[model samples]
Target: MSTPKLYAGLKLREIRTNLGLTQKAFAGKLGVSLPYLNQMENNHRPVSAGVVLALAREFRLDVTELSTDDAERIVSDMREALADPVFGPAAPPIADLRLAASNAPALARAFLDLHRAYRRTHERLASLDEALDTKDATLRPSPWEEVRDFFHYCDNYIDAVDRAAEHFASPAGRPGDPMRAAQEALAHQGVTFTRADGPWLRYFDPDTKQLTLSSRAPGSTQRFQALHQVALLAQNELLEATLDLARFQTAEARAIAKIGLANYFAGAALMPYRLFMAAAQETRHDLERLADRFGASIEQVAHRLSTLQRPGAKGIPFFFVRVDQAGTITKRHSATRLQFARFGGACPLWNVHRAFETPGRFLRQLAETPDGVRYLCLAREVSKPAGSFRAPVRRYSIGLGCEVQHAGALVYADDLDLTRSFEPIGISCRICERPDCHQRSVPPLERRLSVDPGKRGILPYEIGG
Candidate 1:
């Protein structure tokens, strides 16, 4: 099969604009004529191999960004947004959606923002308490959702924070015990670190300059908490700068995003990028092996693997999600084309749900989405014990997977037939185009359905063509 032609006009324009280069200068640097560069920028012509090479050599660009296809993410989000019952059954065709995503991404984002605002307004009016609260009546995206979208659009990678965490882990430019490094970093700042048996995992008293970590928590959690504090104390300016770039509308969103960046810093410091990526490649991404090598938990290892989206040196494009027992997607990030549902729970057919049934073992699945993308998915159940028998345990299942093309690099993909049948899965029932799924909870909004009182198959109504 021939490769698809690349038409990344927006990304090309963005790169040139960021460098403050005019069409002529950018064309000269890219070893292309002004007319040819203009044609490529307008997407009249596909970007050539020569231009890709020139981008790498002249601009030191990550060539992969040219064909990154953020349009896919936009398209998925639009589909989900249109699935709202308020939109009715006559939504725009998928082709038109793709065109809007590719040619007019900003407009598409604006439409999504409008739809999100409408939904929030509708929800607020439906609730009695929020509707009656007349003092503050701002209709905006939830702080958590805003932060999630920020990370989602960023491909779950923050370059500056990631590099800062790496430098903190290796002050002398060499990998060492990240925990010890964090402890010493805190000590240097005249902060006292102590472990005490209590409910709070990690708490810093600003007045006393004392950091208390729960003794009952596992060593990995304690280490991660320490790094998290390091991020806030040592990398405050960087975090604040990054938040400024985000320019969130609400103070709540900014505060939540600060915490998120700190968490990202902790994860990055715990598993330094280059070192962790090398270890992952060497170990074929065995979560247990990675956890042992990095002094991290399996869930942390899985999440860190998804964030290895460094510009020049990127790891496999993987998708990571953590779901509670009830199947709600608590945490999600995808570096691949498979974007998760922005609302509601995960697909029931996916193996991540079965993870809760079998604790302490990895469940492997060869699954295909409705769009024909196949993946080698791995999931395992993780239980966080809260120190005492009276305390409730936090149980969540984490899923990690990459496209089938990169499945060979995963140890979990061994002994599986990569060319054969794959179990079908969808993002969500409301937006999924698959009509014959038995596990579907609701009819697809874009398809017509016929109901008959006398007949019933897997569903009460038959979907129309």
Candidate 2:
């Protein structure tokens, strides 16, 4: 077998910049010529063993982080972006794509941004919002997706906000009853907390000093909403400080992101980082057990698993996804290599889609991505009752999984073969490299197709061999 080439230009450049060293100085320290260092930094050449040692010795850098899957992540993201069909059949060669991903990641991000603008414009034109009024309309990406990407790249964790929440839920602060604690906190500001029979999830009356939660919502949801209100009331300044640092591009994005951050605070506070993490480790991450222990729903527990990236006190990195019956990703966040599709729907072959059929029981899959990474995936359908039969029920399937390397830590992985068999799944059909997939939706954008009417196999057209 051929040796696997190491292309870590982004990480190399980051280390060089962080150390404030010039290319000549860096090369000297690494015992290489300046031209060689430049080539490596641009990913025109692979990072050598000598440079890896030099980095460890000179900067005390973790060599393991240097060998990360940055190239793979970027290549996956770029492939998905280029598969828009607007890019047409004239996609760049794989070598060029890899070069762009490693050497100039910023340009790749810029291209993705430009495409989002086009997609937003296309969506608006199709919707005919205001009937081509063109009033107060400018070319920009969908603010919601923009905000989502902000959190996506942040690994769905904010240290300042997460720490503040841990403090709030600490033993000294967390009261015997979370609802009572919220009432007391709000009462200090002359705000009263109560439940109301209403269509909305949560409502606040500023003039009447009242915070009202929906009576129809589940008890777990009500607790979440109460804590979310507490975040908005008690942690506005800290939230604002974090927002200022993020510097979102648009006001709508800022507003939506503020709510998202508040929601994060609510989940973190309700579960409380240190305690929840301990219970997760002890229970082997049993969703039902954690939910019962923390008075949270299984869905809430699953969602919180994705946000456990609290630096030195981190838990297992998990990817969490929630899909509606129509296969829309209403909520998604990943701290693993398996990022959910940003635009297109997920693969039909994945077990998450089958989750709706198996309600209450968890569905497990040992799946592999095109990048050769495997995961122990778990999915279950969760329902939100409308409090009465007169209204519609809100139903969704939640997916949670970690890398197969950590599968032993999960109760769901017991008796599962992590070595022998695995299901092949991709970010989506558009970018999947699996040529023999019987369920492929579209030929990969990066590959060619061959069609002969007289010949056929699993598919009418044979992908490039």
Give TM-scores for every candidate, taking all chains together and pairing residue i with residue i. Answer: 0.94, 0.87
Extract clashing residue pairs from model 1. Answer: none
Tens-digit lDDT string for candidate 2 (62-117):
67666444455566677778877788877777688788877777888788777776
Task: Provide the lowest-lDDT 10-residue window in model 2.
Answer: 131-140
Stretches of candidate 2 exceeding 4 Å from the true structure: 1-9, 12-73, 93-95, 122-138, 171-177, 455-457
Index of the highest-TM-score prediction? 1
lDDT digits (tens) for residues 209-316 of candidate 1: 999999998889999999999999988999999999999988999999999999999999999998899999999998999999889999999999999989889899
- Candidates in order: C-alpha RMSD to true structure: 2.2, 3.4
| Residue 89 local lDDT, model 1 | 77
Question: What are the runs in model 1 whose C-alpha is more than 4 Å off?
Answer: 1-5, 16-39, 44-60, 132-138
Score residue 10 of candidate 2 by CA lDDT.
82
